[model samples]
Target: MTALTLENFLPYRLSIASNAVSDAVASAYRALFGLKIPEWRLVTILAEGGAMSQQALCGRTRMDKVTVSRAAIALSERGLISRASNPGDQRSHLLTLSKAGWELYEEVAPKALELERQVFAGFSDAERQLLREMLDRIETAVERLEAKG
Candidate 1:
């Protein structure tokens, strides 16, 4: 077979790297708080943004409706979050982190940041910035291309 070229190699490399990073981050967070990735993401968004609707949570987390619904229900049941009728929209309820949730977030957020630092431990600040910029550009380009099709 012919050797792989840059065009074929880069996408595979990026995908592998992304998967590895995601797995590592998920494992670290799970060990820290017994939180699955989706749960952790839900908590983080609620903590940062305060109340939101289920649909809004899905949008913020980039998660599917089913996943967001499940997580929200679990969180509510655990007393880590609360849901109430949206006065403006009866069809959609509002969700918010509870006192327990905020307390957990306060405890976890710093550790999560540290974990992120460890994950990128080898990269210099400049390298990290460049990587983020490149990824953003690529994502924007891909989104535009997708929109056209």
Candidate 2:
């Protein structure tokens, strides 16, 4: 029989590590670009995937609908992103990177990459690859459980 200790739980440890990393990078993003983590995520995703509806953004970002909506609204208000009528979905609007959004992405992407490099500087290439694969496996496991429920 194993004693249950929250500190020793793999899920707890993963959550703690995730929060710590997010917090550290979030501070840099806020300081450098005045963008919150959610806003930065939307910008990065849109830059890579082009215009998408809020529902699609939620799936692509693994963010809740409300969070994605709020980020979209914020970005739109700032003129970084634009919202347009979605021809395919009347209930949803498509979000696209405006000229300003593209400009901001261009500026932020390099800094974001540099921050990523710094965070993984202690990790070897193999370690990083393994960590990423482990995360993907964890996500898959979670999705499997979610699908069951």
Q: Which candidate is the best by lDDT?
A: 2
In model 2, the Cα lDDT at residue 144 comes to 100
The residue ranges of model 1 lying beyond 4 angstroms of the native Cα positions read 1-9
Clashing pairs in 2: none
TM-score of each model, in listed order = 0.86, 0.96
Error of 2 at 110 (Å): 0.8
RMSD in order of candidates: 2.6, 1.0
Q: Pick by TM-score: which candidate is best?
A: 2
Residue 83's C-alpha lDDT in candidate 2? 88
Off by over 4 Å in 2: none
